[model samples]
Target: MNVFYEEAGTFKVGAILADNNTSLQIEAVHGKRSKIKASAVLFRFDTPPLAEFMGHVQKIAEELDPNFLWECCAQEIEFASDALATDYFGHTPNPVEAAATLLLLQNAPMYFYKKGHGRYKAAPPDALKAALAGQERKRLLAEQQARYVEQLNQFILPEEFKPSLSQLLYKPDKNSTEWKALEIVCTEKKLSAVKLMEKCGAIPSSHDYHFNQFIWEFFPEGTGFGELESQPAVENIVDLPHADAAAFSIDDASTTEIDDAFSVTPLSFGSFRIGIHIAAPALGIPPESALDQLAATRLSTVYLPGNKITMLPDGVITRFTLAEQAICPVVSLYLEVSDDYTVTGIESRIELIKITANLRHNELEQHFNDDALSKGHLQHALSKELTFLWNFACKLEKLRGKSNDTNNDKIDYSFEINDEHVSIIERRRGSPIDKVVSELMIYVNTEWGRQLTDAGITGIFRSQMNGKVKMSTSPAPHQGLGVSQYAWSSSPMRRYVDLINQRQLIALLRNEPPPYSRDSNNLLIAMRDFETAYGIYGEFQRSMERYWCLRWLLQEKIQTINAQVIKENLVKLDHIPLVTRVASLPEIAPGAYVKLRLSEIDLLERTFHAEFLQKQDS
Candidate 1:
């Protein structure tokens, strides 16, 4: 006898050889013998053959209409498969018909709900309707996904994806249908999503693509200032004494946050007093004010090639920047120097100084460089003042024990971007302008740091210990600057740490309690936050510079270029600030030159591929 039975929710046919009441010995359709419980059998019959039974039942099941079966059945009540088959066919049903009926009833979950072995109950009217609608929705979505995949694979951007292009390209939602289809297309084309989108004209500019990605990650709240106003203009403006000198600031032309300036006054008998005036934004932006909170969050002005996000609002920066001809509020540190260029007296004051000039590096370098200074004459406005400062800065450098620092000759590259085109200008480090600015700023920072320490006030200091630089609430030595202590009090317009230190210094000058104490939570948090944000901003700046370097390479359309080996397999391209690794590079020492043949450049990925050609003689 052939028996159709259910095992593990699947139906199978086997030939029964013996029956021992509750148990039976049977051979399956595949000729494997096994012991089975008689209760497991759903139906028994003498068949044409056991092997063909299931195949015939399955075929018959397919032809059976499940809806018709459900309609013929009673609702919300259990019925045996054989009984249902008999009711449907209008006759006593055979084993094949019964098994096929059971198969259809088991699979059509929306039409019927199973009760027990070979028995089922019909679903209610509403539940079945909802299930069928959901199934249809899924079918339609599958069709839409297929169409999207097809269009994207053919290098076409679907019209429906236009509104979501930026979100999809930068911050993708994995469960989104558009992203799902894009994922499939990218896999089929063996390309990245960015590359595939660019090929499909979905991305307008690779530069914008990268920029939007950064903005999305770092400035998710958007970079716009909106209508947010700075803290109400400083009230009860203090009556500050006017300094007896005219001051000038030297910075890059693009710099709007002029932090430090200098003034020179000839005193009696070959002695002069040089004043380093720092823009005092801290006086206007009080502690815990809106502007202060905003500066705390940003920590520093974010700089990139051709663009920046200012730490303070533009209006506030304009009010405080040391622009020419404005009597800007300043924190002045004056040093009386003898004819031998040794400091004789040091004094600090809160004052207003009329800014005489805002000297930019490009034009200033032509008149105040090493060659021109050695020639002992310059045909410029601040020649006398610059000449005196140059001599004074030399004495300061010698006093710091770095009179012959090699960093003087190192190259510093600046990028000038105009309407999407870029020009890279190279300037030597430690130039006359750099020395004058750096030495004076270092002097002020060191002096102010010492003042805070002597006054027994805790402030943020930059310390270098064991060749690593870090921020601390307590004063410590900065070995790199050759200073016992270094507090960045000179750039309140640019850096948050400087602003915080500036507040502390201002309170000290006023003989008031310091705003931040030795263990203030706000002070500690600012230190940690500033360090992290500053590092992130620095890395982002470098990445953008690299992006522009690659753009410059493509813009110039040069096929071959020379690169200097910074280390093994790592080379910096000549005439630009780009550094990349060459896999095929031969073993070469640092500073060795290599010629490379350009192979490929991927701006979206910010990467390039090159082949090492030959080593060049030094």
Candidate 2:
């Protein structure tokens, strides 16, 4: 028996050209019989294209009734030659279907073939039936989703593209607060659910983001925000301190708030006198104001893929951080430093420094081998400055490091996927400008810190003790910079504790009693608070970002990715528990050129694909 399988609607046959003997669609009804029987693999092809013919049926004996085979037959078909089509054209009552027809003839007595004389029954495995059903469901869902997206792309708002009505069926009403409110109003309107939701006059309360501008529409004339809108702009303004700080940039997330300004002058004995600018956010915009309160809530800017949510409004934070750049009045910390970066003495002074622009902005880093900031200009400058501040900060960092030495490394590195090429890049090399700026800030911050302590001034102080942060390191003496009483007192734009610290320093310089007593608001407590705030700030941003990034990593196309064992008993993707060496860098493993396998990657579910590269010892 011969069963020829070819792509549906094709003029030429593929299986025959491959020298396959088992199946052939030919002009002859049968091939020459072989004396000996043997096994061979032939005539197997992928499923016939749904839109194309299955192939022509030539010289069939008879057709089956109930027409299951014919109805299920492919959309198209072809015969070996045009002449053969004429001989068998519509001869039988109904032509035999593709597969079953061939099978029926094969099982029949070839010398006396008659399709009506025999019946075919197929009992496929139970698993195959279930698998086919699942595949069908998936196809249907995908088709629906694609259709929804297509319809939505049309008639979107001229200015903004919005989801289609069909797409909204899949969107949950709970997504926004405005939506929640709309649900209530819609239900009360007594209209059909679809009609109520589609009404134009009132947008959903779920759109809290546009609430202030839109709230009026929801209320009757007397109940709306008419009075608030009519109030004079001057009346809405509150009593606040003047902020003349340089505008905040989105690029600097460093410790320096750059609230105030300073200029260093060399003094005797290798000591240099320093100046400090205290940022006064509470002055121009009181902490009680709407903008300030909101900024406090966000605590820091958030960076998420495709979008970002800033802690403070761009108009305020970007323009009102405060510094010498705008000639804002500030209490400055003056101090003398030795060659080793040691502060011999500190003094408090008042200053009107010129601020150039907002310096406290988002942090920018170059990817390995990618430089946009003048080739390590920033990194180099920062390094030199830190090196110069060695006298002051290096000592503090070592003490902290000594306390933190027992901690293990937190970061692991890699670059590869399933033998696909991805190269490893090196850390940044900073520029001279970076070093100078970094050193200047360190010097200024340390000087003021000592003057406040010496002047009996006290306020909230922050300490990241070496042994305190155990997951990464225990809070002990911080080794990042060396100092016995190393603490943060630099930036006030974002940090509440830093603000309080600056206030205390301001008091000392003004010869006024410090507003806070150390006994009441010590640095240790401030550290805890700072840590809490940092965690909260990071939670909304980095923590979620990591989850998404990991998800992307899992769905990457490379079959194998360079991986390193960073920990033991890491969880495998699919929530399937597995144990393996942590962060085992695959490329650096015992051998080279070994094949690897990607077990799984589920981005929607946020999981890592556990790969098995080298085989176990045989």
Candidate 3:
């Protein structure tokens, strides 16, 4: 006898091999034997052949209309498949018709719900309508996905991707259709999403692509400071005492936020009173003010090759920056130095001072340099003052036990970008300009930190111990600077930590309670946030600098460059500040110069392939 039964939601025809009433052992048409429950059997009959049963049943099932069968079944409750087939066929149903009916009902889950073995109930009208609509929508979405994949594969960005280009590039939603299609194409082409998007003309400039990726994460609202409330007029602030000195600032040619400046006034007994004047933004911007909050959010100015995002607004910076020919309010640290450049007295005051000049490094270095100072003659108007300051700086360096530091021999590279072209200029560290500025800044910061400690005030400090640098509220020794304690009180216009420390110093000078107490959570939070943001900004700056270095290489277009091995396959290029690995480099010692053949420079990936040609004589 042939039996049609359902197993694991599939229908099959088999001949009964053994019967135990409750369970039957049967041999399928393919000669595979299985034990199935009798309840799973839809019907039993003597057929033309067991192997031919399913073929005939499937043909009949295909000929029947599922909708008609659903309508023919009872809607209110479950009914047996044989009963429905008998009602539809208008006669006593045979085994083939009953099995075909059962198969049709089982397949059309949207039209009928399976209740028991060979029994089903018709779905409600509303549910069937919703399911059909959802199925149609999925069908349409599949077609749309196919179209998107086709267009992307052909290097054509679909119109749907225009509005979401940044989102797709920076923070992709995996469930999104556009990203789904993009992921498919990227996998097939063996390229990153950014590279694939670039191929589809979605990314125009590789520089902007990398830059925007950072902006998306850090400055999600964009780099613009939108419609800040006007700051209080500088004249409306407290009237400070006018300083009797003509101060001048020394900075890069492109610096607009001039934070620190210097003045040298001859005192009695052949001594000079040197002033380190820092821009007093803390006087105008109070703690928890809008401008202060903005600065706190940014933490520090983000610097790149050709641009920067200032922590303060332009109006605030302009008012606070010690521009030449302007009388600006400042926090001055005066040092009474003897004829021998020994600091005999130290004093801190808040006063107004006229900025005599803003000396730029590009022009000032030509007149006030080590060579010119060594000869006892400088070509600038402040020649005498710069020479005296340089002598004092050397004294300070010697006192710190860093007089003959070898680190002075290191080279620092500065990037100059003009009309998208880059020029990398190398400047030696520990030059006259760098030494004088660095030494004075360090002295003032150390002095201010000491004062804050003596006055029982809490300030943010930068501490380096055991080769690790960190920010803390309490003062600690900076081993590298050879200072007892180091606080950042200069460059308030560029750094938020400097601004916070400046506020504390101002309070201490005025004999008022400090804004941040010993256990101030705001101070601790600011310290933590500033450290994280500063590190992120520094990394971004370095990445951009590296990008420009690569651009400079491509702009100059010279192959076969020289690089010095740092360790193993790692090498640092000669002209630019780029370090890469040469896979083909032979075993060599560090500091050995070698010629490299460069190829396959990829800006998107910020990488290149280098082949070691020959080792050069050291």
Candidate 4:
């Protein structure tokens, strides 16, 4: 006898090999033997051959309409399949008809829900309607996904992907239909999402692509001060004592956030009092204020070629920056030095000072440089002051045991971008302009850090012992700088850590309770967050600088370039701060100059391939 049964949610017909009351041993139509429970059996039949049984059952089931079967049944009521078949066929049904009806009911789960062995119930109208709608929606989405895949495969971006292009490129949502289709196409084509999008003309500018990728990760809200209320008036603060001498600031031509300046006043006995005046934004931007919070979020000014995101707003910078012909508030550190360049006295004060001039390095370096110093005269109006400061700076450098070392004379490169053209200028690291400004700033930071420590006030200090530099709350020696302790309190207008340390120093000078205590959680949290953000920002800046270096190469259209080998296969290109590997480079020693043939520059990927041409004489 042939028995129809349900096993593993599937229907099958088998010939019974042995009959048991609770279980049956049977041989399937395919001659495969199996064991099934007797309760799973729907019905039994004979006379029809087993091979033709399933084909006949499928044909009969196909001929029956599931909607018609559901309409024929009482709504929300269960009944045996054999009884339903009998009622539908208008007579006592045979085994074939009953099995076909059961198969149809089993297949259409949305139309009929199975309750028990050979028992079923028609779905409620509301549930059936919702289920049908969902199925139709799925069908439409599948069709749409197919279309998206077809277009992407043909290097065409779909209109649906236009709105989410940045997100799909930078930070993709894996479950999104667009991203799913992209994944399918990417796997099939073996191309990255960026490359595929670029092939489809989705990315217009490679520069913006790289720039926006960083912006998406770091500044998702865009680099803008959003809806900041009117800042507190800085000009109306408490009256500050004015300094007795005119001060001048030296910075790059493009600088607007002038943070530090200097004044050299001569006294009797050929002794001079040199003032290191730092812009005091901490006076107006009190701790936990709105402006302070804004500064804290940014941590530091993000600088790159042709652009920058300032830590403070333009209005705040303008109010506090030591611009020419303006009296700006400052935290001054004055040093009394003798004619022998020995520092005899040191004092700190909070006062206002008139900025007499804002000297640009490009213009100032032309006059106040080594050639002019050797001649004992400079052509600029601040010639005497520059001469004195240069001498004093040399003395200070010698005192710190940081004399000029020719072996470590590295070149500093500055980038200027105008109308899609790039000019990379190289400056010597230990030039007179650099040394004078750097030594004085270092001395003031060291001095203020020492004072903060002596007064027992909590401040952030930077130390380098064992050649590894780090930020900490306590004071330690910075062996690299040859200073006992160093704190970054000079550029409060540009760095959050400097601003934080400035607040502590200002409070220490005023003999008031410091803003941050030794165990302040805010101080610790700010220190950690600033260090992380500062490093990430520096990396982004270097990446952008590298991007522009590649741009400059293309702009000039030069094929052969010069590079100095740093080690085997790695070299630093001349005239730009770019280091890359040349796979074709012959085994060569470090510090040897070689000519390289550049090819296959990819801006989107920020990479280039260089082939070694010939070694040049050093």
Best by TM-score: 3
The reply for model 2, stretches above 4 Å from the true place, is 1-263, 266-271, 274-278, 287-292, 300-308, 322-331, 339-342, 355-458, 464-466, 469-487, 513-533, 551-556, 570-599, 615-618
TM-score-wise, the better of 2 and 3 is: 3
Tens digits of per-residue lDDT for model 4, 409-431:
99999999998899999998989
lDDT of 3: 0.89
Which model is ahead, 1 or 3, in terms of TM-score? 3
What's the residue-level lDDT of 160 in candidate 4? 94
Error of 4 at 159 (Å): 2.8
Query: How far off is residue 576 in model 4, in Å?
Result: 1.6
lDDT score, candidate 1, position 424: 92
Task: List residue ranges in candidate 4 displaced over 4 A.
Answer: 1-7, 13-52, 63-80, 91-99, 113-127, 229-236, 404-408, 584-586
Score each candidate by Cα lDDT.
Answer: 0.89, 0.39, 0.89, 0.92
Off by over 4 Å in 1: 6-9, 14-41, 48-52, 63-93, 109-134, 229-236
Pairs clashing within candidate 4: none
Each prediction's number of clashing residue pairs: 0, 88, 0, 0
Q: How many steric overlaps does candidate 3 have?
A: 0
Ranking by lDDT: 4, 3, 1, 2
